[model samples]
Target: MIFPEGGGRESHRKEEIKQYYRSFLWSLVFTVPVFLIAMIFMYIPGIKHALDTKLVNMLSIGAILRWVLSTPVQFIVGRRFYTGSYKALRHGSANMDVLIALGTNAAYFYSVYSVLRAASSTDFESTDFFETSSMLISFILLGKYLEVLAKGKTSDAIAKLMNLTPGTAILLTLDDEGNVISEEEIDSRLIQRNDVIKIVPGAKAASDGFVIWGQSHVNESMITGEARPVAKRKGDTVIGGTVNENGVLHIKATRVGSESALSQIVRLVESAQMAKAPVQKFADRISKYFVPLVIILSISTWLAWFLAGKFHGYPDSWIPKSMDSFQLALQFGISVMVIACPCALGLATPTAVMVGTGVGASQGILIKGGQALESAHKVNCLVFDKTGTLTIGKPVVVNTRLLKNMVLRDFYELIAAAEVNSEHPLAKAIVEYAKKFREDEENPMWPEAQDFQSITGHGVKAIVRNKEVIVGNKSLMLEHNIPISIDAEEMLAETEGMAQTGILVSIDREVTGVLAISDPLKPGAHEVISILKSMKVRSIMVTGDNSGTANSIAKEVGIETVIAEAKPEQKAEKVKELQAAGYIVAMVGDGINDSPALVAADVGMAIGAGTDIAIEAADIVLMKSNLEDVITAIDLSRKTFSRIRLNYIWALGYNLLGIPIAGGVLFPGTGFRLPPWIAGAAMAASSVSVVVCSLLLKNYRRPKMLEHLDIGGIKIE
Candidate 1:
């Protein structure tokens, strides 16, 4: 899943940096003498006297010394460029290596010819450019050394995550009666499923497990991004890599190794770095043609310069000292080829994405990859599911009313029996409320229902004590031919108006009672909607609740668009409708019922506390399940893409101005020419600059406005 279109080449980057450093050392050792002999040493009176001595018919001692020192640098230290060029050409393409090989070889082989021709002829005083080729390779290697060093830094977040796991765990041996027999320290990686482990104070959890024998506060800020430590009692699951703070706890391991949350977070961040962004196609297409086009341009520059010089198109003073038309033309050609870079363009996308995704992971937002990050920035509309997304999701019985003559305890007992087998939040709410009527509060026994049937978006039906009990909304009561009386209708209306769901109980096909349950809006829900509006993103609430209750909650949250009583399939269809209208839509939800909508939206975001299916279907997961993270995800993506755009501009701008200058485009007017070695250094610098620009995203933080809210001109920090 690692989309490597722009920059995510995470393979042996450290090794490559080491190799570049090694090659640079070799290049420096040989190239320094060539430069010294040609430039500085030859200018000295004593050195000039010895270097000017004729070694052959016309070749001087300086020429021979420079050639011998530069030969190893050209053929040994620069050999990698040759191999890379051959591989690129064999594959019917070209790259930075091809340009480096061509430019340096042109200078070196021509110098060899000049030296041989001077040795054979007494009158021929040849100017050999042995220093140009050797110096070019040295400077380029230095640039690569710095570039690889920066590339290695972009994945530091993942490295930190991997380091969170503790090395060892205290595994406990339990007897048949669940009493601890013995405890021994073992490697954390050796822990298996169903093993009991003891975590002392301040120790990190070795595996994902529920507390079995103790209570303590566990700090889960690594996963949830919350600073507060959560209280963990028996049956509360603790994530691996989280520190147990106050008390010792015995835990039964549920997930081990890579199945643990910390490992999965690392894998997801790695995958995000690997995936390619949509805009990377622009750089990719340009790169495919960039090298060959530069080669052709190099040949044209040489031809133009040679033709101009041969026909007296320019003044004689235009040529540098000891260089004629052909040699002058050769220098311009080498400069053009050396200065044109493809590496900068290739790195413009992936590096920024790596840093951006890593930053998101640290803040409890798990963006799938470049595609999701790209989509998030452009989202103009967002659909929110009400129950678990904007509301607390945990419902409680706030009120209970009786329609017929029935003992309240007997009535709750029957309702609790029918709901005991169901896993819905509302069902659990009723069962918990009914527990007060039993003498054994902790372990209450309920009457068994003969046949229990649970209906989606409505309620449950069961046969309890020879009575046909139906518990659900008004639609379910009518579907079973049960009529709602005036008093029941008034109560249902009053409950819905209060933003509470009304569940009716029908005993033996007659209406008996109504249970009013309410799930309060999540904290900062209203502020989140207002912030989205200020960001120019429309927020809509979609729920399966009745219009009255849905509208009441939506009004409180400052949402204008509400779609109530929507089935699972209908939610997805609504997302399609928004997309059809040319809007980029994002769906935020937290249940298995929200999976379809999550998959259908342009960017699907799921609450981390939701069902597994919802998380799997989502493109982004809000690990904290907080409303503020939605804004953080969008703002982060926008900032990351802005950095990417800046990279592209820097890379492309460098080439557009560099190629012409190196090719002698300004020589006719200014009488100034760029050297081939300087051109090679500029090419290397361009790539390093692009990578450094991407690395700057590592310092990114969520917006200050998000951290401190201003609602109604009052600051809420």
Candidate 2:
């Protein structure tokens, strides 16, 4: 049930592997005898005497025996190639199948004609090529078997993710009083939204939810790449497929089925594998005309060598001791056709992309596929959001100064009750700080606030117990015509100078107090900026806070460019301006109100803890919510493209050198000629080498500078 949106079955996969094995087995069973009959017996004197004896006129027994064994291999065991070639040619495009089918068919039909002509003549000596056609098909099938096996390893990460879901879970049916009425064991897939599930020690949580009862340490290393166990308590969200270490806990399902994080990851990896990079077009353009060009070159090679031999252009000894000038020319033509492979060129980019994306997923970096990887490698600048992105995102009340003669506890009660309705980080910080004054810590009830309002980029407004209370920045107070005292202005100035957001509390159009809230910089914030500078990337900070507070925070983090007091839409404008300046910009944000900016950048990287819209718009998701992952995403892309370049070099270089030698280009002077079967084997090996070269990316580790970095409060080993 944890299977992705598009369902698949193991039965179908098993059948496909079986089909490949069967084809290879059948080719081997028929091809071995044909090779032995045409090659081995010719060297044995007794068998050579019997092979030389003609059956019907000039036709020998060895030729008839090879013809019977090779016929089935040519027609039956190698039928897939003929079908592939037909499909390719019908679409007006040539592929690897066309070259393979053309080479094997020429050798098979020509040997058949040679046998028929020899039977009709008086003293005709014909060299039948049954071994050549049959062995070529056999070697190609063996190569395919190896290629499929190697390709399966590319999806090992997805398979591991799917297998992490547990089979069953303990379901609990609760009453209106929050008491468990019934408990039963059920399949994990049957869990629905809002359904409470019990997780015991040594069991994985059924789905993503928050715990309503009990506490335990859950190990989430498999999903988020955090190497430690996280403590989960009441009202704390827990992810699916994580192990529960101790203590019995009950979690209500918030997201189930494909909507869970595990399923989303699987879908992302699958999409990445399907999306093609712009660099792949280079190989695609070459493969379209590769076969037809090779066919024309092969025909021209045959005619050149045949006319040379007819007019005695080279020494006669250059021909093999077993055959005449005609056979030498035919050998060169068939070798040329088989050696040039289009498969190698076609596999160069895709295989490397697949391995690179898979390696990224294993390290908790989810890339959106080839297009993202292509853009990320060239990113020279990163735009960072201030609050949640650059800092810990959790603001706390640091200092409070009252301008009016009001009780501190009574003022805070009014402030917390008004700010409780707002979702801004600063509002939440005020509410949390106010909770310290209440004696009822577990469930403190505050006075009801009427007509609550949140002003974007400013603050909030509400009415508490007939008292009109306003909590916001100086702009909100001035906009409402609330006069600010000189003492209040001084307090606000001091708060901004200290890198803290200053909140003005006004009651009945009079400035009452000033509350300074400070959000600490995240661990390694300066180091992140320093490492990005070393990588030749510029760092900029953008925020909705005032210039004084934003500049103070930016200076502490070593950021030279700072944009402050901007609305959500204005953030997107800055991204567009930077992009227009010829910089490949990447926007890193918490996916909150800055979604427009995330969509505008060349590459948008969203933190996993961000809003759903931000994750949807981003090209890469930092699942661990760590700033260091931005560096990992960029470095991974540069390395993957480098590997892709190496693959292309090897694939093209093999074809350039192989095709010429197979055409007997070195034979006339050095008497060194490549046989047709050996050329066929080399062609198959070239394609396999390209795939194997890409598979090496699985061993990729993050850059040395990014190693041993802490993520989500866990010190990874």
lDDT of 1 by residue, 1-717 (tens): 112221234446766888999999999998998899998987899999899899889999999998999999988999999999999899998898998988899999999999999999999888988999999999999988998788788888777777778989999999999999999999888999999999999999998999989999999888877666889998899999899999999999998887888878878888888899898989999999998999999999999999999999989988887899999999999999998877899998998998899889888899999999999999999999998788888889999999999999999989999999887788889998999888566779899997899887778999999899898888888889899999999999999999998889999999999889999888888989888999999999888777788999999999999998887898999999999999899999988778899999999999988887899899999988887789999999999999999999999899999989999988888988889999988888898889999988988887776767653354533
Determine the backbone clash count of candidate 2: 0
| Each model's total of backbone clashes | 6, 0
Instruction: Report the number of the highest-lDDT candidate.
Output: 1
Q: Candidate 2 lDDT, tens digit per residue, 546-649?
A: 78899999999999999998788999999999999999999998846778899999999998777788899999988877788899899999998998899899
Using all chains and alpha carbons, the TM-scores for the candidates as numbered come to 0.93, 0.94
Pull out the clashing pairs in model 1: 2-274, 2-275, 3-274, 3-275, 3-276, 7-350
For candidate 1, the TM-score is: 0.93
